[model samples]
Target: MTDQRPQYGELATPEEQRRAAGLPPLGEIPPVPPMMQLSAPEPVAQAPNPGRSRPVDRFVTIGLLAYGLVNVVITGLSYLDLPTVMNESMKILGIDGEFSNFAQGKLWGTIAAALLVIGWALTAALAIKRLRRGKVAWWVPLVGAVVTMAVVSACIAVPMFNDPAFMAYLEQMSGG
Candidate 1:
């Protein structure tokens, strides 16, 4: 408080002040222009509603979530009746083979179900994030659907592939 020099822990806002404090200019700084009449800031093209979503975006979110809910309910019911369906189909096809590891198939079904729900949630989250940021988000759900179905299909195939008679029939049909 006695001298005109800076005290400890004081920030150097000006280049001259920084130089006086034995500090070099941090980096390339535009040279200061002479004082002139102030002007309004350059008009920035602003968003219609920053950080606020539109009706369409909300509709997309809700519609897809409802779609996911219906899918979960129906697919869950199918999985619950999977064993009976397998037996019936096998009888109709005249295949005498049984499931070697029904527990393993159950595990795969669980994994597929979990992945399907997680994929839907993740897709919605990504779309919402981009929509909030005022970005084009129409493609997210499509891509998510493709990838999620591919993964779920692969997971669901394990159980069917575990049947030896099915594999033998496939091999016979393939000219092997």
Candidate 2:
């Protein structure tokens, strides 16, 4: 018997055949206008302002940076004299000259002071950078300031409270 069924490709209409061939139907697509044929115009480039910080923020940042630098310097100077201070403190407590113990205490005290100063300086620097970047979070600098004050106060207060001389001075000053 002869085969009578249409071939698979030939079963589609002309338009479907055109689409199946990955082409548009004749007279279907419109030509691009001459204006669109040209390349698109380049976008304008804008220069970002590097000095974008406001006056108040700039002032606060500068202050914080200065405070950090001062803390670093003072802490360094204090560390340099730490051995002498420790010896005197030991003498005040009626302790005999034991260089090894004094040296160990001074070493630990210096390390603690260095860490505290470095941490405070870093926090201040970060807050200054954030402020300069136009961030509005006031708490960044505030927290740094508070922590710095607390650290300094603790460093000063602990020795004063422990030392008989300092406590006596305070008592004399207070008339008690």
Candidate 3:
């Protein structure tokens, strides 16, 4: 209504203001180039399906857990007889040294031994199940368990073996 130039907000519509300003009227923005066209969308690779474990495999896992529990109990018992356990271990391993009460923390040492036995049992159960399922190489868990058990035993046994006192005790027990 006024002779003065209308500022931006004073215009009835942006298009009217743009036109009055001697600028091109605003129109719908031209469609953007489709993202797919601009650049090939990296083909989304679907995640791979991890196959389910067979029933036997599940049973084996349970068995392993049981074995592990057993080992834990054994290790706990071992702590109640630390000196004897250490000396016996050393003798079994044929290690020639005296490991005193001050040498190691009995609890952790025993736990390590227990866990080894349990881990082995679980591995063996898994292997046997696999074998029964017609897996060609069946001895996997058995061998693993055996080796683990031996290593765990040796870890505790070596020190016992090395102790002369332990050996003397063994001899006396055998009535030698």
Candidate 4:
């Protein structure tokens, strides 16, 4: 019978197998052209600077600061004139007789106005501080401004509306 078992070195390596099969050696093959090679990876772009503020950031910050300053000024002025305005408004509403004394109503109104001014001032101050530090979210100051305006409007409106006479006065003024 013929020896069927192969020799140890008969197919030891791929190169030897290729040579035995009459194929060309790997070194004799031509290399692929440059165009056939994958184009060099495009250079990566530089990262943006984090320290610089965008135009939108600057716009929001400046706008909030300006609005806050205006709010503080108006609130301060209103506080200073609270008593006179309150007395006049009460007189116009024809409910001056409800208070035992004019001074008492004026005193309470002054206190309310002072409190409102102080609250608004504090909010504005905080928003301004955050904006200066470049750490405030745009919405923070915007929401604060809206809240302050609403409170101020309510402070003026609630008392005026609570007086039954004031509602009647409005009705008469509007000829409704």
Q: Point to the candidate with the largest TM-score.
A: 1
Query: 12 in model 1: Cα distance from truth in Å?
Result: 28
TM match of model 2 to true structure: 0.45
lDDT of 4 by residue, 1-176 (tens): 99986665574687776677787888887998875566556755433332365446656756876777676677656655554565566686565333233343344456556655666566657755655666544666677667766666665555555555566666777999
Lowest summed lDDT over 10 consecutive residues: which window, candidate 1?
Answer: 31-40
Q: Which of the predicted structures, 1 or 3, would earn the higher TM-score when compared with the native?
A: 1
Using all chains and alpha carbons, the TM-scores for the candidates as numbered come to 0.58, 0.45, 0.38, 0.44
lDDT of 3 by residue, 68-136 (tens): 557656764675557666656666866465556435436446655566656665675666565455443
lDDT of 1: 0.70
Cα displacement (Å) at residue 4, model 4: 78
What's the ranking of the predictions by TM-score, best on top? 1, 2, 4, 3
After TM-score superposition, the amount by which residue 75's alpha carbon in candidate 1 deviates from its true location, in angstroms, is 1.4
Candidate 2 off by > 4 Å: 1-50, 53-56, 79-112, 137-143, 173-176
Q: lDDT of each model, Cα atoms only? A: 0.70, 0.61, 0.59, 0.60
Clashes of each: 0, 0, 14, 0
Model with the higher lDDT, candidate 3 or 4: 4
Cα lDDT tens digits for candidate 1, 1-176: 57876665475567767677687686755655553224336655545552465667656756776776688667755655455555666678777775555775677877877888888888878877877777766677778878888898888778777877667767877999
Error of 2 at 24 (Å): 13
